[model samples]
Target: MNSATTTTTKSRALRRFALHATSTCATQAEAYGKCILATYTDVRKDACKEEFAKFGACLRESVRLPRK
Candidate 1:
């Protein structure tokens, strides 16, 4: 395949992975978003550390691509 075809295939794969991850991690993402929104006015460092950590972990697990 040419460079353009390869690039398009990779892009589509990334989009698919992103969509899957978003759906799989929706709960964790919502929690993190709520934490940020709740503290939006008075943001503090590490205020949402727990929520963010959970969200990150979910995304990491959800988006793992299998090796050929």
Candidate 2:
């Protein structure tokens, strides 16, 4: 495949992976979303750090490749 085609294919694969990971971690995603929304008006840098950390951990676990 050409460079452009290769790039497009990789992008699509990444998008699909992200969608799958997020869906798998839906509960963590919802918690993060709720935390953000609740503190939208006066959000600080670490306002939702705990929620975000949990979401990040979930996403990492969801997308982890199985061992051979």
Which regions of candidate 1 are displaced past 4 Å? 66-68
For each candidate, what is the lDDT? 0.86, 0.85
Backbone clash pairs for candidate 2 read none
TM-score (C-alpha) between model 1 and the true structure: 0.70
In candidate 2, what are the lDDT values of residues 1-68, reduced to their tens digit? Answer: 56998999889879867885678788888998999999899998989999989988887776677789
Candidate 1 per-residue lDDT, tens place, 6-62, comes to 999989989977886678888988898899999999999999999989988977776
Worst 10 residues of 1 by lDDT: 58-67
The CA-based lDDT of model 2 is what?
A: 0.85
| Residue-pair clashes, model 1 | 0
TM-score of each: 0.70, 0.77
